[model samples]
Target: MTRLVVVGAGLMGEAIFSGLLASGWAPADIVVSDARAERRAELSERYGVGSGEAVDAVADAQTVLLAVKPADVGGVLEEIGDRLAPDALLLSVCAGVALATLQAGVREGTPVVRAMPNTPARVGEAITAVSPGTHATDDHLAEVTEILGAVGRVITVAEKYQDSVTAVSGSGPAYVFLVAEAMIEGGVHVGLPRDVATELAVQTLFGSATLLRDTGDHPAILRENVTSPGGTTAAALRRLEDHGVRAAFLAAVEAARDRSLELG
Candidate 1:
């Protein structure tokens, strides 16, 4: 059996297990650990992976998924650093934790893969970006990619880009939601019913994205295709420019990236 272990058993931890299983790995081959007794029991009952202690769960796992919080990763890695299998791979979903920090806990020279996945993964519509540490080989990365890609689209970037990835895709969902919220309010302001406004705004966003994705045209081109001179879109664009929306997005993402670096 191809043994895989997931630590933390939180939302992302559990989501990782679910993603692996959906990608064809059997429950018998996976193990999960959580510090809280209730979480362990709950997950074991739900997924059938035994609710063992962290060290026990990861003891022989071929790939250990570090799904703990950014702050907790160091301690967990330190705790199990010496106990992991010599050749086992380390995969982490904890944002802001650097590759070097992860390698410090595991066996010397073990492979490590770091990933940033957004909240949409809960519904299987996530976008994730991954970067490998120095020890991670192509084959090892492929394995990690396969696991993360199960939940959504996966992109591989340099670790140098992970912080930006965190700000964009990782924090991007919230930005989209905020836009949706504003659109819905705008619709309501214009006399549309709340529910109808929400549905229309959401569907428009989804349809626009779908069209852009399916048409294979660049976003700039697709957007230009929609905006006629002196059109409604152009009017909205002027209002958005007046409000400095684009600048706000740049500032927000840049601030998030800086904060991620600061946290690490």
Candidate 2:
């Protein structure tokens, strides 16, 4: 049976498909369709999955995963939405697209799910938030969860909260990268070689994130544990505070959230 049809072969689309294969999904059960013949051919050759046009790919497919660009979503939806099996699931990861839009594009009673997943999905550490549409049932949501789990953690939230989720986890990696860049530059300023500074910054970030996840301690608590009353860490922390780092992050997230709202 052609169980899943992926409707894009872009970066995030490729990531999800690759993750599914890595997690043991059979190639024969998956088919990918892309408007670009080159993309379709490349993925078919690389992953050994069936490739075809969007409408043909979704035919009899139990689930359709839409990973197209925000602007291209409507065209793809129009091409395949009505063709989807009534009981099939339509899971989308297009940022700024809404459940209402997805539902309107699809056949009546087709279950739709809108998800916001970050670029980290390329590395299998993504945190995705999924919102169910009006026709989606618990089983449909579970199916979406199971598919996304091939990449990383999944959370379910109300549709109303998706913009906030996009601001946080969806665009969160860029914020972390910006911090890493600054940290590396700081290290270089203090006389470390650029390569050495990059390694140090990357490892520190990886270790700190691991610590945070493993310990589940409040970030403030963890920072306090590192900062002795008036030590070097405290001095650095004070400098960062004085420089408005915290406020900048707050403003950045707000801006991202507002942009997402505008896009919707």
Candidate 3:
């Protein structure tokens, strides 16, 4: 009986809505809004859910999801400022839009939860971090977590740390992709065929992630386990160190965190 409304049926919004319905929530229990007429029509029929404009979908919903792009978020909030159900919880999936900004635009005392979810969420393997606004409560947190938990793990972080979350995991997928690209190129450099190189690199990345998750061991320890003295991994690691990969990653994450703050 949880009536949910999602604004913006774009990639991330669609992914979350699909994840919820696939997790056994009834299709009729949800609704979505998109500025594009074709998108609204397509998604509603495809998901067997309701669809309409942002101002129209929150009619009696328990939660209204703000999934608009960061750039458009303010305008959408301002547009619906007078119409949003006063008591319905507002859940934002737009990155870099701070809780204060959302709260200021919404009715005073309307509960708001700010969340940072990554690209992997599309495949149902995201790790999301949430931060509560002033009017949000324990019940609100649980509800937001349930919504996000459908697609992946959820963690509570202080609002102050949300920007860092944006840096680390929100933008983390690009970092992993870059690593995969480099690994594939490294394999090609070592004379392997493209398909074989891709397979090796991808499976290795997947297996390494699985190992960390399955064993619950420290990643550094796991790396140590594979890094025998003067072994292949050690040689490659040494080369990576010489190329300053670790330093570059640190600098990149820091830069992203700063940019997130600027956007907020």
Candidate 4:
């Protein structure tokens, strides 16, 4: 039997496949499916994995990864619902779509695991959150975690917390990029060359993140460490606070959470 079938050849799909390969899974053990023949051909050439129609791909597989767009998920599930092996595990990465929705589309009692992964998965640096459906067992959740861990960190959360997870991490990268963009522009406004500003902004973000991760320090403590009394960092931070930057972030995350709930 095929060990895994990834039912989409898009960015995240490709990333997960690549990560699995990097983590020592044989290409022959996996199959990928895409609606576009060209996409299937490209993935086959790029990864040397088997490619075919979605239903055919999952027919004998032990695990089926549903990576299609949220709008397309229902149709894909309907196509493969009856064909999926009775014991196959269904793992979904469709954003905003709930486990209830996935459970409704698949065979009754199918063990569905809903995952929210960010764009950074493309680089194998993503943090994915997995929430189990009513039928999913601890072992099933563990299996999904192991599969996603091939790419980056994987955290298990209750389904209720998934919307907040979607907001905080699923949409988190764009927030970081916006900050990086503003920092780069700010550096340019202060007379730095654009290229130099870009490097500075990028490295600063990278280094700060590394520091926080490596040292296991609270972000506030880390921020305080760099902020001297009446210093340049202090002045900048004061301006950000005066402009309600912190509150804005809070509001933005809440809005994203609300939107995620609406999507579900």
Candidate 5:
């Protein structure tokens, strides 16, 4: 029997499967299914995993993972809903799709879980938020935590908070990238070569994030630690505040949250 069947061969799907393999899942126990034959062939050649149509992939599989786009969720579920074995776990990483919607698509009492994982899963450093569906129990959630933990940190949140999680962590990476872009450009403006600026910005962000994580210090406390009275960091922060950067971020997260609600 197949242990896991991933219903999409996209980036996140590939990430989870690759992470699993890296953590010791055998190739024969996993199968990847994609709508495009070329994609299916590419992953099979690259990873040496089995490939098949979605329906065939899920057969006798203990877990079915849906990594498709939100728009494709309904269709994919429709194709495999009734086909899933009664005890099989259905897990999804599609954004903006609700548990009710997923549970409705599958057979009655089928265990479903909704998860929001960011792009960093590609590097095994993602922070994923998972919420259980109506039929999901503690055992099912523990299984999900183990599966997702292979890629990154897994946090269980109430389903009601998932939209907020979608806004904060799911969309958070893009915001960090934008900040990195601006920082690199700022370095260039200060007479650094583009490559030098790029390296500095990347390392600074990385080091700062590591510090924040390792020290367990509040971000504000960390910022204050670096900002001497009337120093460069202080000057920069003053300018940022003058430009309302903090307010902009609040607005941005709220906008993302509202959009997620609309999508759901």
Candidate 6:
């Protein structure tokens, strides 16, 4: 029997599989399932893992990762619930699906964990937030943390706070990409070549993030450190503030959080 069964072959699923392999999991120890035969074939060919029907892939597995779309999760659980080993952990990355909904579809007392991971998982730098269901134990959460830690950082949060976590980190990558896009365009507007602008914008974002992570300093302090009185940085920041960029971000995150709640 496989040690882990991934029930979807989408980008996040592929990222998790890649991360696990990078973390030294043998391909033979993992199995994958997808609705499309072509996707199954692709994953098997690319990762050298076994591929089959969801029920077949999950049978006797130690852990079952439900990486399917939220709309499809119910059907997946209904199909595999009985087949899952009694002690197997059910770790889900289906956005907007609640633990109660997942538990409703599975066998009684089956441990369930819900995770919200961003696109950065593709690059092995994601920050995933995990929450436990009614039956999930501390050990189950730790197991999930270890599994997701293969991709990046993992933090435990109460189920009630998951929607907020989803809005901030789950949809956070697009916000960063939007900022990078604007910065690149701003450089182009200042007469820099597109390629040069892209490199400068991308590297600046990367370096700034690295500095913030490594220094443990407040972001305001970092901003102040870079902004000399009446300097270019100050001028640019003033324009952003004048345009209510911060307020816009606040509203955007609230909107995202509201939508996540609606989806659940």
Off by over 4 Å in 5: none
Model 3 steric clash pairs: none
Residue 109 deviation, candidate 3, in Å?
1.2
Worst 10 residues of 2 by lDDT: 78-87
lDDT of 6 at 126: 95
TM-score of each model, paired residue for residue:
0.95, 0.98, 0.97, 0.97, 0.98, 0.98
Q: Once model 1 is optimally superposed onto the true structure by TM-score, how far is the C-alpha of residue 121 displaced, in angstroms?
A: 1.6
- Model 1: per-residue Cα lDDT over 1-264, one tens digit each: 237888888888887788778878788888888889888888888877766888876777898888988998878988888888888999989999999889887878989999999888886778888898989999998888788877888889999999999999889989999999999999999999999999999999999888988999999898889899999999988899999998999999999999989877
Under the 3 Å rule for N, CA and C atoms, how many clashes does model 4 have? 0
Residue runs of model 3 more than 4 Å from their true location after superposition? none
- What candidate 6 gets wrong by more than 4 Å, as runs, is none
The candidate maximizing TM-score is 5
In candidate 4, what are the lDDT values of residues 62-160, reduced to their tens digit?
999999988898898889988989999999999899988899988897899999998888878899999999889999988898899999999988889
lDDT of 5 by residue, 1-264 (tens): 788899998999999999999999898878999999999999999989999999877868899999999999989988999989889999999999999999999999999999999999999999999999999999999989888988999999999999999999999999999999999999899999999999999999999999999999999999999999999999999999999999999999999999999999
Worst 10 residues of 3 by lDDT: 52-61
User: Candidate 2's residue-wise lDDT over 1-264, tens digit each?
Assistant: 488999988999889888999999999989988889998999999999999998987977999999998899888888887888767889999999999899899888888999998888889999999999998899988988888988889999999999999999999999999999999999999999999999999999999999999999999999999999989999999999999989999999999999999988
- Candidate 4 whole-model C-alpha lDDT, 0 to 1: 0.92
> Model 3, range 195-229, lDDT digits (tens) per residue?
99999999999999989999999999999999999
As for candidate 6, its clashing pairs are: none
The parts of candidate 4 lying over 4 Å away from their true place are none
| Per-model RMSD to reference | 1.4, 0.9, 1.2, 1.0, 0.8, 0.9
In model 2, the Cα lDDT at residue 64 comes to 92
